[model samples]
Target chain A: MSKVALLLGSLRRPGNGIGIASWLHPVLREGLNDTSSGTAHTGVDVVFVDPTKPPLPLGPIVDGSHVPADIRDPSKHPNPNVREFATFVTSCNGIVVLSPEYNRGYPGELKNTFDHLYWEWHKKPVLLVTYGSSGGANCSALLRSFLGGPLKMQVAEKAVAIKLPKSHSNGSDKAPTQGPAPDWLEQYRPEVLAAVAEFKDLISQQSSS
Target chain B: MSKVALLLGSLRRPGNGIGIASWLHPVLREGLNDTSSGTAHTGVDVVFVDPTKPPLPLGPIVDGSHVPADIRDPSKHPNPNVREFATFVTSCNGIVVLSPEYNRGYPGELKNTFDHLYWEWHKKPVLLVTYGSSGGANCSALLRSFLGGPLKMQVAEKAVAIKLPKSHSNGSDKAPTQGPAPDWLEQYRPEVLAAVAEFKDLISQQSSS
Candidate 1:
């Protein structure tokens, strides 16, 4: 089984970034073209990396006779979550970054996560799935150069951008107050499906070779 | 005096971004070519916008017979700092953004401040002064598009990039731990002066017209 990491870039809850990913997670798991749904997107497991998840307990890992001793091993990170986060990335066959372009740039938390680990990123295939008012065009372009050039990662050609409409008009230009449009998921289904398929294909080739 | 906003993007204190800005602040105040040292930069007032400043006190504005009643005015923002920040931006004739490329992007706090106020940014001349290993090339490019396009702000032609030498060799690609080379300020002095001169010229025209 090929495991893929779905990294959440934005912290906005019920926003378009997470909303779109939630909508497509189950759909992609059943396989895009398979008319009869089977278990998991053709044996591909996606690990959702959300930073909001409660941090690991401060105490030592629970000891058990059945547990592997190395399960408690956390590389060398001062923060347990950061150590686990990096370790989890090593297990993934591919990665899909769900980032929302904020102020024509990507989020800081996303960069914070990427900076924690280095060697695990080399030659790993990454698919950019971004959402924003401009469909995250600038965000995707910058990420492409950074991932492909500096990190030497295999960035997928099928980069997806889910553009959300401008619906907020409260006279202030902060964040959008409301959630996404009612049918945003239905409208962007095809794009999401296509991007996920490309990611699966890349990892599949990696495993086979 | 033509007021300019120097917005600091990165929080690193001894780092290049702030170090370069600190070096140029006084030099610009004295004017580049003038032999006589002046108190201000050719009638241009540069405001340093750092997010780490203490927040405005919760109490009401100090009441005094001699003081203006509205001096304690903070617009409509729930966060007092944000309100004061936006209010202050409106008074500036031009802006200088001091940013560093983090993981190939920019600091989140910078974007958070920009997103807070929209109308204040319209037609405001902005000079991008960025520091990174790539001399903030990608960061400057992205900000140029962002400020010129959506924000509808005036972007300076001479964007300054104080490229720092890659000295952090602790095997982590995260952030440059050490400060810039001892002579980095002297090395990048000419470029920063040129950019600030261009910014001064733009704001001079704004005040004259």
Candidate 2:
């Protein structure tokens, strides 16, 4: 089974990140469970990583000292959170980042998390999932540049963008209670499933090679 | 006299943002005073705006509600910070942004401040000044898009970048006590002065036209 990490980029209680994640999580699970068609496949394992509960203090990362001589060397790093996060990333076969577009870019918190670990992210396949009024096109572009340029991660071509409606209430204090997926989101369900399948295939191919 | 606002994008103590700002501020002042070059120029008034001491709470801006019915109308907005910042932006004949590169992009706080007001930024000529390992090329590109796209601000072609040395120490607690500019920074001094002159010329043309 290929392990996939779903990194949520926002911390707001009723933010669009949670709302989209709530919908994406189930759809992804259903995709993993479906094995009746075509070749038999191992189901995927999914884990959620939230940027709000940062694994390590962002000072070192922001100051550009988070990377050491040997990225996997625990002795060089004292932060347990960084070690744990590094372990999680290295173990994962692929990653899916769900981020809200903030001022035409991804949250700094999310970038901080990525900056904390360097070599652990190299060669891992990543899928970008963004939500916003402009469908997060700009933030997704920026994220792709960072992933491809600095991190050297294998970024998937097919990404998912959930465009929130103009009237969508964001930043409300209430936790997003599970409800029927909106029609707008329902239309994008197939695309999300396709992205998951592609991610799985890419990871499997990389593992075998 | 033309009023120019200098927006500092970094909050880190003894960071590159302050270092570049200190250099640019005086250069800009000298440019404003030097009218003997050719055309008799009006004296320039420079004001420093730090994102660390934000005039308003960032909630409304992050949620994308900072745009008022009439972007120039302060009566429609309830946030006092927005109104105060709006006044500052509108009063300025031009703006100069000095930002430090963080994670291959501009700081979130700087983006948050821009999101807080809309029309106040329209048509205002802007010059980008960035400093970092890669001379903040990526952050400057992103900032240009922001200035040209949503804010509808006029961006100058001439920009200044102060490339920090690899051995430079950032985030030091020691106050950036006045000292001679480092050798690397000294090389970029002429470039900074040229950018300031270009910015003054752009703003002057905009005012007359």
Candidate 3:
């Protein structure tokens, strides 16, 4: 059984990015669940690391947990929240991030989450789900470079973005109320499945290696 | 007189980035103070924005003082931290950001600070002051792209980085004693100064045009 972490970046309620993630969660879960019948067994357990609280810390781990000391002491920390988030990420095999494009990049809070845990983030597989007024295309593209270049995270190619303004409904129901899944979800379902499969395989290989 | 807003990315105490800004503050002040003679007046003021408290709310303002709806019903309003920070940035002629690298990008929290407000960040002139293991090279470069492409910020080419491990010290002092600003600063200072001057001229021209 494999465990997958779902890290939500937005702290706002009724957030467009989170709403999109909610729609896609079942798809990822279903994809993971269906993989078991194949030669490999795939099971994903999702964990959401909330950003409202303090994040993991950097440097040596003092407590019994692999958690850093700064997370426990934010006053002396550059970004305790990011460190704690990194600790959470370290515990997971793979991650799916619900990123919101703000000012044309991943939110500052999300960046802070990574800044605190540089080494722990290396080699992790990340699937980004983004949404913005511009469908977050530019944000997701630039993010690919950062995650791939510096963090050394293996970001899955088949990602999803909910193009805002065009996709959003002006009616009372601003949320995705189109039911089971939107047409766009169906269109990208194959890539999403393939990415998750690759992630599971990578995790399994690393575990054995 | 030129007013430079020093927006310190990391709000932590005794942070090296902050310390560097502190060290440089006097030099800039002296430069400005000393030039206030003969024919012209030269003065510089640097203000730092602290992201620790409740920020002002977003929305249209009638007199640049209050948001009517929020004043009437604070409970119905979204968080205002982003709006307030944007407001501060919009008021400034130029900005100096003391950014620390996180996962090869700016801290998410700091980024979120801007995400919360798009209108205020559209045409601002921003300068980078970053540090990290790689002297925050990748992060700074990526940040420049995001600022220029999405946020539409005029990013100053002149930047600073404090490479780690090599710069690490065993001294008991809380703040790490960093060597002199990287030589890159000298190379980019004129470029950045020109960008700032040009941005200011452009903005003034637009308003008067």
DockQ of each: 0.11, 0.19, 0.35
lDDT of 3 by residue, A142-205 (tens): 6787778867888877777766554352222234534666665456667667776766666666
lDDT of 1 by residue, B1-209 (tens): 56676777765444455556666566555453332431224556666665566331112211111112113343755556656766787788888888876556555455545655566777787888787777878778877877788688888798878767666211122233344435654676667677666766666566566
lDDT tens string, model 2, B37-154?
A: 4234667888877654655334323233333423567445556677777777778889989887766777665776676677777888899988777788889999998778867888
Arranged by TM-score, best first:
2, 3, 1
Off by over 4 Å in 1: A32-43, A54-74, A78-81, A165-184, A207-209, B1-3, B32-45, B54-74, B78-81, B103-109, B166-184
On the 0 to 100 scale, the lDDT of residue A85 in model 3 is 57
Model 2: lDDT of residue A196? 72
State the lDDT at A17 in candidate 1. Answer: 51
Candidate 2 structure quality by residue, lDDT tens digits, A122-195: 88889898888778888899999988777888898889887777765332222244888778777888888787
Candidate 3 local distance difference test against the native: 0.56
Give lDDT per model, in order. 0.61, 0.70, 0.56
TM-score of 3: 0.72
Interface RMSD of 2: 5.2
Quote the positional error of residue A100 for candidate 3 in Å. 2.9
lDDT of 2: 0.70
Clashes of each: 1, 0, 22
